[model samples]
Target: MTDATANTAPAGAGQGSLLIKDSRTAKRNGAEGRFKMYGLIAVCIGIAMLILLLTSILTSGLSAFWQTTIQIEVTLPEEKLDKSGVRDPEVMAKVTTFGYAPLLRDGLEATIAANGIETELSAKDAAELISDESVAQLRNRVLRNPDLIGQTVSVEVMASGRIDGFYKGRVTYASAERDTNISPAQLQLAEALEDKGLLNTSFNWLFLTAPDASDTRPEAAGLGVAILGSLYMMLIVLVLALPIGVAASVYLEEFAPQNRWTDLVEVNISNLAAVPSIVFGILGLAIFINFAGLPQSAPIVGGLVLTLMTLPTIIIATRAALKSVPPSIRDAALGLGASRMQSVFHHVLPLAMPGILTGTILGLAQALGETAPLLLIGMVAFVREYPEAPWEGGLFDPATALPVQVFNWTQRSDPAFVERASGAIIVLLVFLLLMNLTAIFLRRRFERRW
Candidate 1:
């Protein structure tokens, strides 16, 4: 064949090859476009789910922050709260909440009469419209300070949970017919009082500051004690877990010889991360409570349990961070005759601090929302009194953590406790959110590029 003819044949073969390559490229690009679309759809679904969750929580939990209060202008009788007209503790002890109820009823009745809001409700029904704890609250004030016994002071008392619901439009006349704590007539009287401004609904700061009360007094119940308990537990976890976790990571990553033992330990740490949290609860119960003889429901025990649960998480993150550090940096330090500890601590650790902190905070956040381990330690029990002190009560006293408190509230027979439970959840979420945001901030602040 001629040379030109042979060249043309070769060119034709090359053109065929180009066509095949173009077709494959087009098919690959189409597949990539479809994958991108799938990712976008998944992200949209996630955002929609988050929005729904927040809306539901806000709608159900918002009512717990505002409570109906009956403003009573009462003349504190000297004989009731302070019989001796002196600040005597013995005399105050003799008087009970019942003794203070009549005085409160008379004051409320007088206020109603003065307001010209005529109702056929008896004094007992009128007092029932307000909170039963109001009497005890006033009596406690007089017992604390006898100077206020004869003074006419205006006290804003919480209304009964049912009455409060009535004012908030949660309980209607038809619903009152089936309710035992409130009747249709009582709701009607409450509305009348609300109209005259004697009873009104406002934001309740007490819910954030006061301690949890009985189921009958949901309006008075607060998550403050639980919040403090969780704080103490977190403090213990932070102090105990961070150092131990970092130390283990440092030794494993920089100094420890890679042997079968080390490999086994690494595998077990990873496995522990995936273990069921309730299993940790069981372990904590058997080891800490039964064997160690630690106090039941103490924040210290809860902290120790959480520490065990959190250590694996921190260690994994820390090791990953240490691995991310450039070997060149370590070599440079060593070439300058710096000791191994100095090189690791001064250069490597500072670089890895962000990741370590992020991991630690994330683990703590997980511990904060934990309920099962706390339940095993008796943190689910009813605790009315505030803990004495961190050092005094933290190790020995019975305390309820926030998640356990929320769980306890949900199991109550009263509907108001459900609202309180939702409120407690909101508080817990806020705490978790704050911790997560802190982790993000630290990560961004201290992150280094190799």
Candidate 2:
């Protein structure tokens, strides 16, 4: 009767009721809520940073897709361009770009006169607004169509980099006064030209199609060689790494004896995955260039180096993919009178194809952006000429990659090159995004459920 009375007293008499709030529970809930808030804050910070970075890249880089150009009608005197009445190709070639320079200057002066624009700038200064690269363009145009030598044809040419920067808001009149390469009068003349509808910014396809230009001629620089070199290297990587990495993974996972040798190989592959890419560059330099006699700065050498660096990743991803296949699938195939090789190839491989493709593409994308190994192989050299078609053995030719091009441009003293470097970064980022999107699409499209 005494124990029953004690137990039947108010529920909170001896200890706190389980349904009621306790100090420890309240503290624990507060901590959990604080943790959630912290996590939310961290996520927001990361998202904001990403938005800021992308905004910066887009703001600086998008302008590179357009170029400043001036259109003028140049009276190409037959005597100066084509001395021979017959307009012989050899004779036309004898006239240097220097000889064509005065013609362009005269054309500019004539344009100013015709447009009724007033400027106190001298004739030479007026011509200075035109890109020095234009002289070569004019000469090439005449050479291509010798008949146009005698006619007053409308020739459109790039404006000087300074004038271009003016349109892009990179240059100001006050700043031009302090600049040695360009003058206030030149900017005034450029402004006048624009007012007269003779100078304007247009889409710059050459930025993608033309080759790299010299530091002095940043107005004419482009990414043609870098693009081709990168494409070639990626092709090589996809071709070589896919088959070799897959075959090796299959043998290790499905056929090879589970022994020390295989274990050692697996360990080595994992270690290589973590090795610095520059180490592979060093290895490539010694073996490919020094011992194997492959040419320096050749895309072939870069491709081979990238292939080596990419293989370990491909192998690891492929092995994971193979292991993900259900063991029952193998049993089902074996029950249908299939050999070990037949089961893997006909049954397991099909289900794993999506993962294999995703891994291979991601590996290629990584190799595409890698600059260290390519730089070590001498691919950072200035390459002005585009590589030939693949069937012509162009893989062995000297070339630069997109990343190396960005590195090269950033090293220049010109502010224009900095803009170019940013633009190149944008291009590289676009390619990477596309590749990643493709990986995601493939994974979703071909993914199978048990």
Candidate 3:
């Protein structure tokens, strides 16, 4: 009996030894520390790449925020600004920007002489060193307020793009030989004027408030008009896309049966989300612009195109959100004699709202940065005037979006417009970042777990 008991104990110890061997084998087959470290290195590399991208954008874009300006005291003789002391609108209409050029030239000459700067530059050349927009600006103000037409007013005028670049060290005298807009003489005069405090650099509010200018008026160009156009398009997108997308998502996720037709729809939606944005632009051009006869280059058409593109993303997100709600919760609500709609609307939808909002904002950010679609829809056309009310002539009027404006500026020959393009990009990126941040905030604020 003792021998038999000893034999059973040895067998039990052998089985335990086998189990320990198997456990050791499993640990040996698991991922190694080196493999895990490789993943960590990959993540670190990705973060470094992201930092490099941000640093490049910020460095190139920071210069766009400031501009060179010249402060001039100009005596607007009543003869030029207001031909008739009676302030006749007809007389003011006849006075062109050219009429104000002489006054600016005179002011520049006075400034140069007063500063005792010895230069061979003529008054015309000195004034040309400043922006042509300044002439128009002075003329417009005098016409608007005829009371100031005869008075000597202190005005701060934007410097010419080349002059501005020169002052900022972006354009040196050596580079000016290739530039047709400015010369070394102009640069020297600008330096002399800077020394006398008549010319200086300051934060460029006009870049935010003014509109796009001609190729010759880069210093005068601003993002205000394009920003408005983008806003209008977004307004249209939000008003139309959000409700329709959410409704479709709810029906598909909560009520639609798992049929072949539903399957086809789901598959097609996923494909549409993957379609290139340029395809949507082509679709918009064919359907909205050519076939439907919607106004070309209008924000309305742009909005419609963006709405179609954004819908797939929003629907996918909303459905995912709805699916995240626990099935037990839905069953409980239904078992309490609540309708399917009631169960979804009361329990499921509230839980899904945060995800839905986050997705919508991300989609809108995508739309905001879209340039290819706008390019196809004639948003590349130059727009000089602001559109009217949304319900009025707005949908038919020519408009330029921010991205489109940036694209247009980059294509110009002027170096200053490059800076303007960079500035526009900065503005667009700010909007995109804000939208993304809002998505993050929404996710954190309303996220729930079952």
lDDT of 1: 0.86
* Candidate 3 wrong stretches, greater than 4 Å: 1-31
Error of 3 at 353 (Å): 0.2
TM-score of 3: 0.91
Per-model TM against the reference: 0.94, 0.94, 0.91
Model 1 TM-score (2 dp):
0.94
Writing each residue's lDDT as its tens digit, candidate 2 over 1-450 gives 333344466776436555565565567678889999999999999999999999897888788888999999899998887767788888889999999999999999999999998989899988889999999999998888888977898989899989999998898999998998899988988888888899999998888888899999888889999999999999888889999999999999999999999999999999999999999999999999999999999989999999999999999999999999999999999999999999999989989988888888889899999999888999999998888877898999898999999999999987888778888899899999999999999999999898
Model 1 residue 310 lDDT score:
96
State which candidate, 1 or 2, has the greater lDDT.
2
Model 3 clash pairs?
Answer: none
Kindly list the per-residue Cα lDDT of model 1 for residues 296-323, writing each as its tens digit.
8888899999999999999999999899
Residue 318 deviation, candidate 1, in Å?
Answer: 0.9
Q: Judged by lDDT against the true structure, how good is candidate 2?
A: 0.90
Q: Which candidate gets the maximum lDDT versus the true structure?
A: 2
Predicted candidate 3 versus true structure: per-residue lDDT over 204-321, tens digit per residue: 9888778889998888998877988898998888888899999999999989999999999999999999999999999999999999999889999999999999999999999998
Clash count, predicted structure 2: 0
